[model samples]
Target: MKYRLFGILAVLFFLAWQTLDGMVEGDWGRLEGGLANLSIFFKESMWPPNWSVLEARSYPVCEQDIEFFCSVGYLGMMETLKIAFVSTILGFIGAICLSSLAARNLMPLYISLPVRIFLSGVRSLPSLIWAILFVIVIGFGPLSGVLAMTFYTVGYLGKLQYEVFEGMPSEPLEAGRAMGLSKPSIVANIVIPENGNHLLSQLMFMFEYNVRHGTVIGIVGAGGIGYYISTYLKFLQYDKVFALLLLIFVVVVIIDLLSLMVRSFVNEEGDVRKPTWLNTLLKAKRSKASLVESE
Candidate 1:
């Protein structure tokens, strides 16, 4: 059976790879042309550095006063990331709550339907639009970007979490209730424990999405790498642009690897089984013996 499964997987993988190769080959000319255009664009854009504006912006970056232009640009990126992180966390928590109530098995159609519609609406609005609108109220910076990302994440994560909740086996929940547990107790003791790993996985996955978006929101003045990118690119500083892009690439890749490790750790659900009564009592006795020994 294992061999059969592996064979099937190999065949499927080959077919998928072949399909992708065909698509890439079909677009080869277009891809090459696009690449050429991009190269030309960068070559043309990268001259005449805006040294004057850069000089005016000459202020201390992070209190060290390294260089004005670079510092401001970096400051903007830091703000962007701060917004993304804060918003992602807030949105994820909100989504967890909404997802719990929104699960079809847990709630009736009337309740779940409305929540789903609201979430859908939230998802419909692009984060960029939210940033633009909030930028008016907040008047720029990472604050607006964070708010936009949070709202969007709440919608997205809420929907996905509900799906996760719905897919969960009811047996454990039923077992908890059969012992006369309350709904909240069942959720706290069983639902959360069972879904803890899944939730962690989802959170790790969303971090990448948030980072990508954190870039976009910067265009409307949300801050982060985007602002610096815009500044250098506008001045035709392709080298600096490449430098910034390299930084983003490295950071994102490193974060992605860390997330993968976390996913692996969580998926294992290390020692998830509840402690047996005897095991707990035995451990307690051991602790008591150690205390007596100390005396």
Candidate 2:
């Protein structure tokens, strides 16, 4: 234990030293100067937030003679949503197909082992790195972002789904086999229905994650909100940047609420219980009503 602790500390110290050396080589003094004026910088950049950017009318309209017209921020946001939505759907489908073969309980060792390894290899790299590679190969655009997100999603959702499949009770499989059901029929009719809610939950979570990733990939010219963010930051337009950030936050919150509602519905019983907090409140209300009736 003593030697292990010493090794860990030594590794940490070496990492810290490397970080400091890189900072020094990259002119750490500039960062220190910026930190010293951080308050001033925030005051100048974020004060009197120009919320007019959020108003649709604030966007410029092209002349009637012009062939096209669009708001940059609005279009960028929509594009980001599109990239996330499309990629997530494609990824979920791919994950579902691969997961059946990947599940150890559902497939032979030779088949499942290779599938698991392939998924692990795909997941080893971050989505940003994948986006960069796709950008180089496919050229900069939403296509690159879509492909990157899809690949990452497959690696991610595949692992989760296969585990879920593998963990399923053996009773159902045994019963299905006794009934002479084929493997494909057993999986489709029995396993899928049993785990429908979990699969949907995973897909929703992945969609939320992909939305955030979509924005980051756009920074590399994948053509989404990140592209607009990069452009605004380059021009030092912090107001617009903040506006876009706010829009993203709002959208993410909406998605979260929607997912919560859907999950609640999927898990609902006779009562409309959902969102644990709300369920508790409803239970309290019912208790109060029962006491009043008894009185």
User: Of the candidates shown, which would achieve the greatest TM-score relative to the real structure?
Assistant: 2
Q: Quote each prediction's TM-score.
A: 0.71, 0.77
Alpha carbon lDDT of each predicted model: 0.74, 0.83
- Model 1 lDDT per residue over 1-295, tens place: 9999999999999999889889788565566678788877767764333323323244433344455435544555466668778988999988987887788877779988999888989989988888888999888777788888999899889888889888999899778878999866776788878998888877877777888778777777877767777777677677666655655676678667767655555564324423343434464575566578789
Candidate 1 Cα misplacement greater than 4 A, ranges: 1-33, 42-57, 65-74, 269-295
What clash pairs does model 2 have? none
> Which window of 10 residues has the lowest lDDT sum in candidate 1?
47-56
For candidate 2, the per-residue lDDT at 178 reads: 93
lDDT of 2 by residue, 1-295 (tens): 9999999999999999999988689665567767658777767896655565544433355443422225566678889999999999999989988898899887889999999999999889888999999999989999999999999999999999999999999899889989999878988998888888889999999999998888899999887889988888899988778877888888898888778767767764425434454543365676566578789
The count of backbone overlaps in candidate 1 is 4
Q: Once model 2 is optimally superposed onto the true structure by TM-score, how far is the C-alpha of residue 66 displaced, in angstroms?
A: 17
- lDDT score of model 2? 0.83
